[model samples]
Target: MSIVKNDLADNSLNDPHRLLRNMIDQVPDYLFVKDLDCRFIVANEAVARIHGFESPDDLTGKNDFDLHDASSAARFSQIERQVIRTGVAMIGMEECVVDAASGKERWLSTSKVPLRSANDTVVGLIGISRDISARKRDDFLRDEQTAILEMIVVNSPLHAVLDRLVRLMERQLVGVYGSILLLDDGGTHLKHGAAPALSQEYCGAIDGLPIGPGAGSCGTAAWLGESVIVADIASDPLWKNYRDLASRHGLKSCWSAPVLSHDGIVLGTFALYSARVRHPEPAEINLTQIATRIAAIAIERKHAEDKIRHMAYHDMLTGLPNRSLLTDRLTQAMLQTKRHNPWVSVLFVDLDNFKFVNDSLGHTAGDELLKTVARRMENCIQPTDAAVRMGGDEFVILLTDLPENTDAIAAAMHKIRAAILEPMIIRGREFHITCSIGIATYPQDGTDAETLIANADIAMYKAKEAGRDGFRFFTPELNIKAHERLALHDGIRRGIAQSEFHLLYQPQVELEFGRIFAVEALVRWNHPQLGLINPNEFIPLAEETGLIVPLGEWVLYEACKQNKRWQDAGFEPITMCVNVSARQFHDQNWTSRVMHALGETELDAKCLELELTESLVMRDVNEVIATMEELRKVGVSFAIDDFGTGYSNLSALKSLPVSRLKIDRSFLRNLVEDDDDKTITAAVISLAQKLNMKVIAEGVETHEQLTFLRENHCDEVQGHLFSEAVSSTEIGKLLQNQQSRSGLAPA
Candidate 1:
C-alpha cells in the first residue's frame, strides 16, 4: 500500500494540470483558465477572491458574463478572441466591472493569453486580473490635476487663471463649486476673480467685498491666513451677512483657503461652495491651494518680465528710445528697403559746440538743454519716423517710405536745423544751440547698415567743416575727401619729423614813411617732392591736423632768433610779429611758451609781437584779458591780426594789451578803388588811433594802394608793395641796405 501511495504522489506532482494549478495559485495576481464557451474551467484562490466568491469551486464552470456586467464581459470576450486568433499574449488592459457578490463597482487591469494545443491550434485561454482600482483612480486624478494646472498657466491676466482653475475644480470634485477673490493693496478688500457660473449674479453682488473678520468666507480666510469653513452657510457666523446672497444662488456650504505666495504673504483666497451642507475633503482643499500658489508665481513672473523689457528699450534720462532699440529698428528698415526697393533715410545729428555750452554753464543747464532739444527734435519728426537718442548729444532720425527725389531729405534737414536753433530757457538764461546733420539714403549711399552708418559719419564731419548748423548729403566726393584729409594728417606728422619746413619774412613797411618798420614772420613748406608749398595750402592743414602746436613753437623760436640777429647788426629795433593760431593762443601753456622762446633767443621782449585774430579775443574776454596782461607785464606785446573780419568788439580791443591792429587783406585789397574797402580801412585806422594803437595795412599790391594807406595815416603796410615774403638770406641783404641808408654800418 505504501509503494502504491508513493507512485500516486509522483504522478500528482508531475501531472500538467496539477503543476499549472500550483503555479497559478502562487502568483499574487488573480489567475484563471476558461473553456472556449467562456466558462471558468479552473480558478486560483486569487481569482475566486477577485470575484467575491467563497472559494475556487464557486467560480469554476461559470462564464465571466455570469459574474460581471454585460459591458465588462463583452470587452473581456473581445480581448480573449484576439489573443486566441493570434496565439499571443495580451497585456495590462483596464476595464470596469461590478462585483457579483458585493455589487460594488471596481476597476481591474487584466492580461489574457491563448492556451494552444501541441499543434498550435487555440482551444482555451488563460488570464490574469489585478485589483488596480486605487492606481487607476490616482492616475485619473493626476491627469485631471495636470490639465487644470495647464489651463491656469496658459490663460492670462491673473484673473483669467483663477477663473479657469475654479471651473476645473468644480467639474472634477463632487459637491464643489468655487470662487477666487484677490486681495487689494491695503488688504482691506476682496476683488472677485471667479465664481460659480450658475451663481455669477450672487458673486457680482460681492465682487469688491470688504476684507475683515467674519465678513465672508474669503475675507475670514485672508485675515487668518488659513482655512475658514462654514459647513452650513445659513447658520455659520462667518457667512451671516452673505447668507442671503448665497441662499439666492443655492449655495449651502462654503470653505475658504488663503492663497499665499512662496514667502507666505497672502495674495488671495480660494473658496469652495457646496449645493448641500458639507465639509471639504483634505485632497480637495490641497488641490485648491496648489492652484492658487501656481497662479501667484505666473503673475509675478509676468510683471517682472514686462518691467525688464521696458528698461531695456527706454532711455533712463529722457524716456526716449535708446541706441539698442534704435539700431534694431534701423536694421529692419534697411532690410525692408532692400526687399522692396523703397527709399529710406537715416539722419545722424550731432549737437554743434555742445561741449562749449556744457563747460561754460553748469551740468544742470546742460541737462536741461538736452531735454529741450529732445522735445524739439521729437516735434520735428513725422509720425512714421522715429527719433532716437544715440547717447550724449547725438540723435538719429529714421525715415521710412520717403520720396526718392531727395526733396524730403532736404526738407527734413531744414526742419531739424530750425528746431535746434530755437532758443531755450535753461536756469533762467536763454541759450541757443544747433546741430550738424548727415543724411545717408538707402540704395544710393550704402547697401548695408555698417556702411550706411560710416557714410553718415563722414557726411556729418563734412557738414561741421562746411560750418555747423547745417546738413550735408552723403556723396562719393565727400568720402574721398575724408580719406584724403586722413592721409594729409599722417603726412603732416611725418613732415615735422623730416624737418621739411622753412620760414620767410614779409616786410612790414611804415605806411607814412615808406620804410620797413617790422617784418611778419611767415611759415613755408618745401616738400622734397612738391617744392615751395604755399602757407595757404599747408598752414590750415597743420591747424586741422593739430600739428600746429609744435610747428607754431618752431616758428616762434625762429622769429625771435632772427629779430635778435637784426638788432645785433645795427638795425633799429623792429617788432618781429608771428601769427599765432587760435588753438595755440588758447593753449594752457601759451604764456610759458612765449617766455621760454624770448629767454632762449635773448631777444628783447618788446621786439616780439604775437598776433591773434578778432575771434580769439571775443571767445572769452575776461580770460583773454588776463592772459594778455600777464604777457604784457613781461614786455611782450599783442596785435589784433585780420581785424574787422570776425565778430570784432571795440571794447574788448580797448581793454586788450594790444599795440597794433592789422587790417584784413579783404579791406586793404581794394582800398584804392572800392569805396567800401577805403571806408573800412580809414575807419579801422581811426579806431586804432583813438585807442592809441598802431594800424598796419596788409595786402598792398600796387603803389596806388600804398599811397592811399600813406594818406590815410596807416602806421604800417605789409604786402608786395615793399616785397613778397623772402628767404632769410634775402632778409639779411635787405637789412644791410636799410642800415646803409640810415648811415649806420653793420657791427
Candidate 2:
C-alpha cells in the first residue's frame, strides 16, 4: 500500500504483476472480468470509482446486483451469460444505466467477449464500456422534436402537445422539472397550460398568478417579455410571494422564458424548476429559448383555429349564434326534451315594418337598427338560452329547460317584446320599432329543427295577422293547416305523375269584329278522389314546394300541342296564351324549355304568347328584358298579366318585348260600381293603347263590366262572358261557329 511520484516504487516494479495491475487501474474506460456466476473477478480503478468504491479490490468478488439496481444487474447478467454460453463477442452494444448514488442516466457503448480456459472451454466474460451519453442525448432531442412537430401538424390538443413538450424537456435535462403557463385573453395573468412533472397542489396555487415585476419567474418573464432566472427561490425578491409554495414543492430555483408571438407580443412563458439552488448552464438556457419558440407556434395556431371556428358558428354583425349553430343546439335540445315540466321552446321574432325602415333610411341604417334589436333580445334572455340571428331582420331565441307552464313562457315572451319596444335612433331620426314573436315547443309543436323553426315562423305570421307587436303560441289548427298543405304538396306531385291535370281554353273576343281572336289556356287539377282542385288552391302550394317549375312546363307543352292539333283540324290559327310562374320564368333553362315545347308540338312561335305577372317582369328589368328579347327573336312574345296590380317601372316596361297587357280581374270586378276601379281600368287600357300593346280584360262576367271595358277601347276580353273556360272539344266547336254566334254570353 505504497506509492511513488506518479509511478510505481522499486518494490512494486520488482513484482511485474503489481506493475501491470497499476497500469491497468489507470485506464479511463471501465474494464472488468466476471466468473461464470456473473460475480466480479477483476476490475479497473474507473469501474470501482464509478460504482462508489474506494479501491478495485472493493469490486472484486462483487456482482452488478451488489453495486447497481436489480434491473441493471439482471440486464448485465443476461448479456454476459449469452457470451459465456456461445463463446461469442458482443461488441459496441449501446445500453443505458442509472448512477447508483446520483440517480442520473448514462448511456454506454459496451463490448463483451467470452473468457476461455486453457482447454478453450467458455468459463467467464471480459467486458468494457465507454460513456456515450452526450451523443445519445442529441439523438433523443432530434427524435422528440420531430414527434412534437408531427403532433402540431395533426392539430393535437394544446394541452396534450404542451404536456408532451414538458415531458420532453424533463427527459433532456434529467431532474429539472418543466411547466408552461399561458397568459389570459387580457394578457395580465398566467394560467397553467401544462405541468405534469409538478404537484397538482402547487400548480393550482399558481394557476391564475398575475404577471408583474416581482410575481415569480414565469410571471415576471411574461410581464417583461424576456427571460427570468432565479437561482434561489427562498431569497430572490421575485419569488417572495411564491416562496412558501415553492418550498412545499421542494423547488429551490427556476428559469423562465417568454413565449412571444411573431409580432413580439408575449403569449405565455416556458419555465424549468430545480430542487437545487443553482443557476442554469448555457445549454439549459438555450433549451428554454427553444421551448418558448415552439410554444409560441402552438399557442398562436390554436388561437387562430379557435377564431376561425368562432366565425363559422357566430353571426359577424350581431355576434350571435348563426343558423348553423342554432340548428345544432335545437337538435340537441330536442333530443334532451323530457315528458315532464322542463321544455325546449323556439321563439321566432320578426321585426315589424323592417322593410319600411330599409326603404326610408337606407339599408345601412336598417342594419344598425337590427343590431340594436339583437342586443335587446340578447339582454332579455338568460345565459342558458341562445339568441340566434336567423338572417336579415329575423332572430330566433331558443329557450331551453323551461317550465311547461304557459304563463311563465308568456311572461318571457312579454319581457322580450318589452325590450324591443324601446325607442331607437336611426338615420338621425328617433324611431320606435316592435317585434312579433311566435312560440313553438319541442316534442309538442314539432320535433325536428326545421319543423320547429317552420312552425314558429307560421305562428309569427299569425301574430302579425292578429296584430303586430304581439306573441302567439303555435295552435293545433295551424298544425292541421300545415299538414293539409304538405298533403296537397305531395298530392300535386302525384297528380303530375298520374296525368290528372288538363288544360282548358277560354276564347278571347276581338272587340272590333267579335270573332274569337285567341284563347288563354288555364290549368285545372282533377284530384280524382277530391274531384276538382282549383288552380288557385294548388298553384301557390306548388310554388312554395318548388314544384311549380315542372307543373308550368307541362302547361306550356300541352297548350302548344292543343293549338297545333286545332290548326291541323282545319281550324284558323289563333294565339295560345299560358301563364308562367315566377320560378319558372326566372329559371336558367326557361328559354330552352319554351323552345322545347314549341319544337315538340311543331307550333309557330308567333301563335304562342307567354303571360308573366307584372311583379315578375319588374323583379330584374334588365335581365327580364334580355330574356324576352332572346325569345322575341323567334316571334315568341310576352304579355304582362295582372298589369295594374303591381308596382311596375313604366320606364323599364317600355323596354320589355311585350305584345299585350291584361288588366287584372281585381280592378275589373268593381269597374262598373267603384269609380276608382273604373278610373284604373280605363287608365290601364289607354296606357296600353298608347304603348301600341293590345289590352285584354279578363274575368268579364257581367254585361256591364264588358260594356265598361269595351267603352274604354279594350281590344280583347276573356272570362265567363266568353264561355267560362271551356274544354278543348267545346272550344273547338265554338271556334267553328264563331262567325254565326260571336255573341260570347253565358246564356
Candidate 3:
C-alpha cells in the first residue's frame, strides 16, 4: 500500500501523523485503520497483501465482511464494537482469522484502540495484529509431546512405553512411519522392540535381523554404533539382502539411529520408514535420536524390574519357585480347586540324609545335588504344577487339577520319589538321594494353603519316622498322633528340667539262692498331669531330644547313692544297675559323667553296673568297645540290655567288655508258648556263657518262666515271679525278706 507523498513529506517535516505513518510502514507487523462502520480506511503494504489486495487503495473501502468470511467478519465486528463503545483498548487478543490471500486460518495476536473525535466521542477502532501461527503451533506441539512422555514414564511398562513413543513420533511427523529395535541380550542381533503401525508379518520378518555391516538400516546402525540413513532401500547396499523384505512391506527408505546408554554403549536402534524413496531431514534424524534415548531408558528400567521380580519369586540356587511364589501359586490352586472341586495335592518333600551329604561332602556338592534334584522334580510334575524349593533340601510340589482320588495323588508322588531316587554323581562320586514325601489334598486333608502345606509337612515327618524313601498321605489320625508326639517331646524336656523322675528297683534275684543279690534301677515319670507315666512312653522321646544325657546322669547318681545308703544302714551291699540310653552312651563325656556320679555318692565302682541296649552298643562297635574298656578299668561292669532283640553279631558280642546279658522281656513273656522265643532265649543264654558273661532273664512273671530260666542256668531273674518293680522303701522290705529267706533254697 502507498502513502501520499505530499502528506508524508508534510507529516515528516511538520506533522506528527506523517511521521507515525512512515514508522508504521517501516514495521513488518500488519497495520490497519477501521472506521465506525467497521470498514478498512487506512492500511499498510503488509495488511493489504494479507487481504489479497495489491495496495491500500484497493483495500481501504472494504469492510471486515469484504475481507473475511461471514463468520470471521461477525467475530471481528463484535470485538471492534466493544472497543469503540467502551473507549478502551483491547490488548493482546488472540484470534484465528482466515487469511483472505491464502484462504488458510492463521493465529494472530491483535490489539485494538478506540479512536475518539475532537468532541471526545468514540469514532472508530484502530487495530495492530501480528501472525503468531508458527509460534503458537510450536508451543502446542511441545506441550503435547511433554505430556505424552510424562504419561509414558509414570504409567506405561517398558514395551508399552516404546510402542507409545514410536506411535507418537509417527503422529508428530505426519506421514513418517517408524519402529524401535532392541539389542538381544547377547548383543548379536536386533529384535522387535516396538512397531505399532507395522504389520505383524513384516515385524516378524525383520525381528531377528543380525547386527552387522550391510544388514539393513537398523542392523547397520547398531553395528556401526551410529545413525544409518538409507535414501533408497532398493538401491542401498546396506539393504541388499533385506531390500525385498522392505519392498514387500511397502517401505522404500529407512533411517536408523543407534540407541545408546549414558555411557554411549549401543543398546538398540530406532528407525523411521517411508513408502517413498527419500533421505531424512535433519529434524527427522534428531527425532529418531530422541526416540532412541527414550527407548533405552524404558528398556533398562524394565530389565531392572524383571531382575528384582525374578529374584523375589525364584530360588537363587536351584532356580525353582521359592516359598513366597509357591505359597502364592498354592493359594491360587486351592481357589481353583474350590471352584472346580478337583483335587490339588501339596507334596512336601524332604531329601533324606541330606545333612549327611552336606557333612561328608562340602556344601558345594550339596548345592549341586539340590540343583539336580530341582531339575528332576521339575521333570516329574506336569507343566502346570509348581515345584518349589522351600529352602535347604526341602521342596514342595503343588500338583493341580488331579482326579479326586488317592490313586492320582499317589501316582504323582510315586513319580517324584522315583525321580529323586535316581542316582546322581556329585564330586566324582556316585550318590543316591532319597526323599520323604507327604501329600495333603484340597478339601480332604485341608482347605486352605497354610493348612494344606502344614499338614503336608507333618505327614512328611511321619514318612521320615516310618523310614525315609517313602510317602505318606495326611489323615486326621496322623494329625492327632503328630500333636501327641510333640506334646510328649515337650513333656520329656519338662520332666528332666523339673526333676519329675523317681527311681523304682526291680530286684535281680540269684536263681540258686532265691535271694535278692542286685537291683535294676528303673525310671518312672511322676507327671503332675498324667500320673505314673511309663518309661516306654517318654524314654525314646528323651533320647531323641538329647535330654537322656542329663536324665541318665540323674538315674546313675540316684541308684549309686541309694546303694551306698543301704550299705550305711547296715543292710546288704548290693550292685546297682542303671539303664543308659543310646544317646547317653554316645555322649563323649559318658564315662566321666558315670565316674562323677559314683564319686559323689561314694559308691564302689564294682557295685555300679551300666546297662546299654545291644543295639546301642552295636552302633560304632569300636567306639562302644573303647567306652566299655574305659568303664571296665574303673571296676564298673557293663551289661548288654535286651541282648537278643538287636542283630548284634556274635563276633562283635565277644569283643564287648560286658559282665552280663539281660534277655529281653518279649522272649521271657512267650518263652513256653512260642518255640521261636524258647530257642532265642536259650541261644542268648548260651551266647552269653560263651562270651564269659552272666545271663539275666527279665519279665519272669510265672513259675514256668522262672523254671525255664533256672533250668537254662540263667544267673539272675527279675520279674513279678519274684516281685514287681517296687519303690525304694518296698525294695528295702523285699531285700530284708530275701535275707530272711536265704536259709531256704528253691524247690
Q: By summed lDDT, which 10 consecutive residues of candidate 3 come out lowest? A: 738-747
lDDT string, candidate 3, 706-727, tens digits: 8788788888888887777889
lDDT per residue as tens, model 2, 577-635: 99998889877689999999999999999999999999999977888889999999999
Off by over 4 Å in 1: 1-457, 461-478, 568-571, 743-747
Reference-based TM-score, model 1: 0.42
Candidate 3 at residue 603, lDDT? 94
Per model, state how many residue pairs clash: 0, 0, 0
User: How high is each candidate's TM-score?
Assistant: 0.42, 0.58, 0.53
| Candidate 3 clashes between residue pairs 3 or more apart in a chain or in different chains | none
Q: Write the per-residue lDDT of candidate 1 for residues 538-563, one digit (tens) a residue.
A: 78978854589989998999899988
Off by over 4 Å in 3: 1-28, 42-77, 94-107, 115-123, 131-142, 157-164, 167-174, 181-215, 222-225, 240-251, 263-268, 331-343, 353-369, 401-415, 418-432, 481-747
TM-score of 2: 0.58
Screening candidate 1 with a backbone cut-off below 3 angstroms (N, C-alpha, C), the clashing residue pairs are: none
Q: Residue 128 deviation, candidate 2, in Å?
A: 2.9
How accurate locally, in lDDT, is each candidate? 0.80, 0.88, 0.84
